[model samples]
Target: MPYVITRLCTNDGACVEVCPVACIHTRPGAPQFYIDPDVCIDCEQCEIVCPVDAIFKDVDVPAEHAEAIDINASFFRQNKAVVGPVAFETAWQMVQRAHAYAASVGIAVTAAVVDEAGVPIAVGRMDGAAPRTAELAVSKAYTAAAFHLATADLAAQARQPWLRSLVVAHRGRLLPAAGGLVIFDGITIIGAVGVAGGSATDHDVLCCQAAFSVLETGGH
Candidate 1:
């Protein structure tokens, strides 16, 4: 049996905090907290606190959300990937990690943290975060980390006369400059963090730092 958090959940986190066994991994900083079905007790407490009415039994899981069942399963299986051990971290934690650095630099920023597959896992906006800025941050981050190539590195490598033509063709689509970082567990790329409204270079550094913080701080 599986328990799923549906689209109706507003990510308020009340349900996440209430679980007795802590089967849920909804860290305070995650974008959307989810329950590991294998760990759930089929308890309805999560369903009880959800303000947006998003929780549901896996048996009654919506057709659109059916994929979540598999996602939950994949989350629990212990495995060693090229990077290292696979672990799940919350999106909120990712943003907070990046925000700590951005704060020091006096940059008000927002972030959209996502999985390697380009799915949004968490989104956060600091004071005055622009919509376009948030979007660009996510886009650039995804482009950089998904291909496992840094933006600047890519641009420099592309500068060869032969590759320049290819670079020109791709243009802005291949933002290898900075401002993005991979979210990973050991060797596995679990997700990514992107920040905007600051220097691209600084944002990039913070993005990575924040993601790493989640792993270190354990999503505080």
Candidate 2:
């Protein structure tokens, strides 16, 4: 889960400097900083550097500021990709569209889609994809959905001691590799797309990017 910036934020911007992904944002006149959940890798660097001790993990948010969890998430929901709620059918359509794009480019790949809860909604492997491609795709999709960040971004975070400990704590649930992207409806992450069986990480990222583009255009 992502961390929450509480009211105690002193506007020091210390957390912002330590964040490798630069997920923290603030304006000159703003009272406090905002951490974009979609971009945070949950590396806890901000938590370690906050002079005011204002940052808290989503699940550990104080009772008085319990609303901050939703508050942080709602900030992203302002511009939704779909007018209505995302559903299983919509997730499936996204995977199908990604598969089609991969095929068109002559890249046989496996793709997986997972909902906001990191539950698998749809998965597919194009003909001639590696046998293990489906499993890798699913793991990548789950990681993106659970962390609310692209797997490529996570690849860097995975090198951190805290992040590596998290991987051990989760027992390998988090796969920090390329080819996974968070699917945003506007700024709110609705799901994630993951692709595998490409010639390299860059190729896998390309296929996932195509899928994200479809989501960005509202599946057009």
Candidate 2 lDDT over residue span 1-220, tens digit each: 7898988888988998888656677667867887777667677899999988999999899898787777666655553454333566666677777778778778889988887767788888888999899989988988888777788987976778977887787678778899888776656667788888887688788888777665567662
TM-score of 2: 0.74
Report the Cα lDDT for residue 115, model 2.
76
> What lDDT, from 0 to 1, does candidate 1 have?
0.62
List model 1 lDDT by residue over 1-220, tens digit each. 6578764556677887766335565445545667765446464667777778777888988898887767555555543354421233467767776777677777777776766655667777777666677777676566555444444455454454433443355454435556666655764566666666775566655655665676676662
Off by over 4 Å in 2: 1-8, 20-30, 34-42, 52-85
With a 3 Å backbone cut-off (N, CA, C), the pairs that clash in candidate 2 are 81-185
Runs off by more than 4 Å, candidate 1: 1-89, 158-174
State every prediction's TM-score relative to the real structure.
0.50, 0.74
Q: What is the C-alpha lDDT of each candidate?
A: 0.62, 0.78
TM-score of 1: 0.50
